[model samples]
Each structure stands twice: as C-alpha cells, then as structure tokens.
Target: MTEQRSSPTTSGTTASTGDDGGARTGVAALVLLAACTALAQGLARYSFGPLLLPMREDVIRSYAIGGLLATVHMAGYLVGAVAGVRASARVAPLWLIRTGMAGSVAGLAVLSFSTGSAMVGAGLFLTGMGGALVWLAAPAVAVQVYPCDPGRAIAIIASSMGIGITLGSVVPALVPAVGGWRAVWGIEAVSVLVVLCVSLLLLGSRPQVSARAEESGGWRPDRRWIWTVVAFAAFSFGIGTGMTFFVAALRDGAGWTVRRAGATYSMIGVAMIAGGVIAERLSRSLGRMPVLVAQFVLAAASMFMVATGMGPVVSVAAVIIGTTMSGTAAVVSADLHDRYSPQQMAAAFGLMLIPLGIGQMLGPTAGGWAVDLAGDPFTAFMLCGAVMGAGLLPLVIHGCRRTRRAQTPLITGR
Candidate 1:
C-alpha cells in the first residue's frame, strides 16, 4: 500500500508543525474530537450495560428480551458502519462527527422519556447508529491533526471510549439520588450536547482529511483478511456477552449489590484506558498475531473466572477481559493501517466491522437463552468462553503452521 501523508489544514488554512499557534489549535481540535467520541460511544452506547438491570425492572422483564434490545442496538450499529464506509467518501470528517453527535443527543433525549420496550429499543438504535458514525470518522480526523504519529493518534481516540465507560459506571450509584434510569439518560443527553457544542467551537472548520477510495481502487478482502475478521468476530462475541450480562449476573446470581457490581465493573474501563497502548508496544516486540493469540487465551481464562462470580476473582477477571478486548481491536486496527492507504482506510475498516458487529449482535441473545435455560448466568458465561476459544481455532492453526515453516532448515542442492 502507498503511504498517504496529510498536511494539517482547517478551512483551507495550512497548519504546519513550525507554526506554534496553529499547532496548538490542531491539538485542541483533536482533544475535542476525542471528547465527542467518549460521549457518543461510551456514554450514549455503552451506558446501556450498566443501566440494563434497572431497565429490566422498569420495562423489560425477560432476560431474552433484554438481550434482544442489545441486539437491536447492534443491528443499528452494523447498518451505520456500512453506511459510514460510503458516507466517509463524500462527507467531511467534521460534519460526520457533528451529525453523529446530534443523533446521539436525540437518542438520549428520547430514552429519557421512553416508558415502553419499543421506545427504549428505538432510543438504543439511534444511539448505536450515532456511535458508529463518530467512531468511523474520529480516527481519520485524529490522523489528519497528528500526521506524524497516526498510530498514537488512533490509540488515543480508542482509549477515550474507556474514559467515558469509567464515568458512566458512576451512574448506577446516582440512580436513586437523581430519580430513576430515565433521569440518568436525561442528564447524559444534556452533558453530551454541551460537549458537542464545545467541540463545534473548537473545530471551527472541517479538517482536510479526504477518504476518497475511488482514487485508490477501493478495498478488496483477501484470504488472510478473512481470517483476521473471523478472529475479531469471535473476540467481539465473547466481549459482548461478558460485558452485557456482567453486572446482572453479579446481582442476580452472585447476590451482590448494584453499587458493588458497578464498582467492580469500573475496573474494566480503567484497564481499558491503557489497553491500546500496552498492546501496541507488545505487538512491536512479540508480533501482532502472537499478541492476539495470547489475548484470546487470557480472555477465555478471565471469562471462566467471571463465571465463578467470586468477588475478588471476578474483579481481576474484569480487568483482564477489558484489556484483551480493547487490545485486540487496537492491534487489528494498526494492522489495517499498515496494509491499506489512508484513502482506503475508512472503507476497509468499516467493512471489517460487519462480522464483529454480527457476532456482538448474536452474543447477548445467545447468552440470554443460556441463562434462561440454566436458570442462572453461569452456563451462559461458560458458553461465552468456549465460543471465544473455539472461534479462533483456524487462526491458531494457521499461525502454528507458519511458525513451523519458519523453523524448518533449507536444503541446498549442490
């Protein structure tokens, strides 16, 4: 792939590294974009996991239905991701970011007043769509601002989602004080809107980060890329199942308080904040495939611990799972950057997300079925671990064969 370098420019004004004022403005714009990512993805989308129990009590009663709601959200995300691939080719990154944030704000507002399952699903769907658009465009904008270190910029953008997750964990604690779940959504809507406005002010003009795939002969998937997608899908399945039901399992099966579960869940977000950086460094020394394989193995072990529901062990497990989840995505994204030109990056990455999204969509509902059948979440969690392990078998075997080939001695004919 040809390397594409972007010179930072906003509203057609060039901002070179030597210009101190312009550099500062670019940095500020990048920071605000990261904030938008946090609100759009972390608060609007993932806050659902922490608030699921209350939602169950208030509107959704069945575990199956609860899981279906998550599936509905993922469906919207899948659609958005696919659409983003095309949209990125035409729209400015800043406009896409702003539009996405607006959608999230609307979704959160709708959720605050929703009293039935249909309304709740609608809100979640909109939130999921908004989150996808922001995530799709944010990294490209970051790369434009920090052209010297695209990897670092992307990692920072990825990590910001963890910050949002960590903050959202505090919502469960304030559930009673502020009213119920509806009030929580209302507060988040207002907060996200405030951030969106600030982001608009900071990002005065569109960053000239063009993603015209037509110039690069668009993205085409190969056999190796398919294997990577499969691996990612499996990882998503395990993570989606584990995260979606984690708090509920602790409360219902393990008999823990909501406060305690929420506290423990916060560890996942805390670890996730450093996950991308850690994975990037490790991949530099160990190679991405080996690092990814180890991550899958560790994730399986952690999910098993989560199944046990022991307090301390589960907390440790949460950290492990969180790190692996974010680390895997970071490693995969870096690999994509290495293989595809900037023009093709958006389309390639967006297409790749489809399988992972499908896996996530299926995970929660399958876990819910397992829970309903077993009359507890233990079997569901165990099944998730098994699914994660099983899904990566092809990739593992391919890696092993490649390693063996490398170690073999070459025979010379004289």
Candidate 2:
C-alpha cells in the first residue's frame, strides 16, 4: 500500500521533510506525546482505582461515596469529550494537548492535598476531563508529526496508556513508604509536570494545519461513520463492565486472595502495552476490517471464559481481554482516518468518544446491578460477553457492504 502524505499546508514545516533529522524529531515528539498520554490516561485516571480504598480510610469512609466519586469522574470525562469536539474547531491540537496536560497536573496536585470527599471528587473530575481532552486531541498531533504513518503513531499513543495503568497499579505498594495516599498523588503530579514541560519544549508553538485537511474535502459523518461510533460505544460498554468486575470476580467468585487477584489483573495492563503493536502488525497483514472483527470475537470469548469461574482459564482470559481491548480501539481509529479529513478528525473522534464515555458510566453500575440481582458475578460477566456479541452485528454489516461496494466495479467491468 502506498503511504498517504500530508500536504505541507496541513502538516506544517516539520511534516514536510523526509530527511533523517525530520524523522528523528518526529519520533521524539511522538514519544513525548505518548508520555503525556501515559500520565493523563494512565496515571491520572487509573491511579484512582488503586488509591480508592486508602482514600476511603483516610477521608471518604463509605464505599458508596467512593463509587460516586468515580461516577463524577466519568461525568467530567463526558463533558470533556463534548468540549473537545468544539475545542478542536477553534484551537490548534497542540493547544488542546497542552491545556489538557495542565488540567491533569492541576487535578493531581489537588488530590495530593485533598482532605475531604468533596475535594477528592473535584480532583477526580478534573483529572477525568483532562484525560479525555488529551486522548481526543493527541491523535491529531500524532498525525501531524508522522503524517505518512498515522496508524503507527496512534498505536504508540494508545499503547502508552497501558504503561501508565501498570505504573498506577504499583502506587498502592508505595503508600506506606510515601507517607500516605496523598503523597502518591503528589509524586504523580510532579511526574506529570515533568512530562508536560518536556512536551512543551519538544512541540513548540508553531501552528500546523489539521492532519490531511487538504485531502479531506470537509468530511462529515455518514451512516457508516455513525455505525462505527455505535460499535465503539458497545466496545466501551463491554470492556468497562469486564474491567470493573474482573478482580472482584476472581477474588469473590474464584476464592482467590486479594494479592493473587490483583496480580492477575495487572496482566491486563501489561498485555495492553503490546496490544497496539500487535494490532497494527495484524491489520497490515490481514486488513483492518478482518483484524477488527477478530479482536471483538476474541474479546467476547475471553469474557465467556471469565464467566466460567475457572481459575486457570480466567487468567488466560485476562490476557486476551488486555490484548484485544485497546487493539480494537486502535484499529477502529485507523479505519476512521481512512474517511475523515484532518480538520474533522479531532471533533469526529471526540464525538465518537461521547458515547464511549456514556457507556463507561453506565456499564459498571449495570453490571453491579446484574450481579446483585443474580447473586453471582459470573452472570454479569456473561452479560458483558453478550453485549460485545451484539455489538458485532453492526460491524459485520458495515464490512459486508464495504466489500460489496469494492467488488461492484470488477463485476460491472466483466
């Protein structure tokens, strides 16, 4: 396949060069952006999961309140996702990236000093907004830096979130040594600040046009794109429920120790780091649509395994879910890039994420209710699998239509 080149007007001076130095700079910029993504998506957002119990002990006493705080964070993410669509139309992607990073830093700093549930909830809300903004805008910047290979660039950014989640999982272990949960937040704040500064230096204030704007011809959402967004929401719903209940299922249903369950859960994060790379390679070899379909099937199968409550099989299921969850999103984004103009990509992607945010907000609560009603976490797991299976219908239909359209010319020519 011929690599698509971004027009100079769209990509700015940095993307116009094919020299070795240009490539090095682009790589460096992408790495820095990936680091920002790690902090925003990984640490700032996920560190809450590990820190929640300790935070409850120190300030918030009720698990219900803690759960409510998480919901507030998701609400903020939904708001940010909506804002990102409008923000992309009025500002540069780099501006969105930097501003989002600043929000994460501020939220983390707030969490470090929070003494009450309200304060912690506020901090989480800020972090959620920041995370969503960064995620929505970073791909646009990635396309600018690596115009010829936006898929790879996006994969790097997506995979880096796994690194953050893995590191966040380790934060609880540091609570005693760090003096408290608050101190862990302090350290994370400093870490995010360091990355933010480096990103500012690496990506200067030069204005670049939207990625592929010249070739996009002002793209708008059609039936296919709308279907893609719905599929994305279903994907989010399935993964959110699965992740929310994964460790609980192992510990409560399979009679595993807390340590053992957490260790098994960490495997998901570790596998996620490799998910994007694996997906990109497979998409290159097998084609994006086929790879995407295979990922969903694997995810559904893995969820079924978890529902079985077989300890060994559940371990394998965790790994499979980790590998395919992020991988599916990467493939979906790359597929969307095939259709959207650079100028529209950020807004379009952000619009798609709104449903994902809603799904995330609803999935865990619904899963918890299902478990309560059925008196078994396994039932909820089965429901997650069913949701994913249902999600596959739209993608299959869209893919079949796409294939038929591609073949029509050959048939008519004959």
Which of the numbered candidates is closest to the native, going by highest TM-score? 1
For candidate 2, what is the TM-score? 0.88
Candidate 1 lDDT, 174-212, residue by residue in tens: 789999999999999999999988887767664566544
Model 2: per-residue Cα lDDT over 5-32, one tens digit each: 3443453444644788877877888888
Task: Specify the poorest-scoring 10-residue window by lDDT in model 1.
Answer: 1-10
For every model shown, the clashing-pair count is 0, 0
Q: Once superposed on the true structure, which residue ranges of model 1 sit more than 4 Å away at CA?
A: 1-15, 211-218, 405-414
Candidate 2, residue 299: the lDDT equals: 87
Q: Relative to the true structure, how large is the alpha-carbon lDDT of every model?
A: 0.80, 0.77
For model 1, how many clashes?
0
How accurate locally is residue 148 in candidate 1, as Cα lDDT from 0 to 100? 61
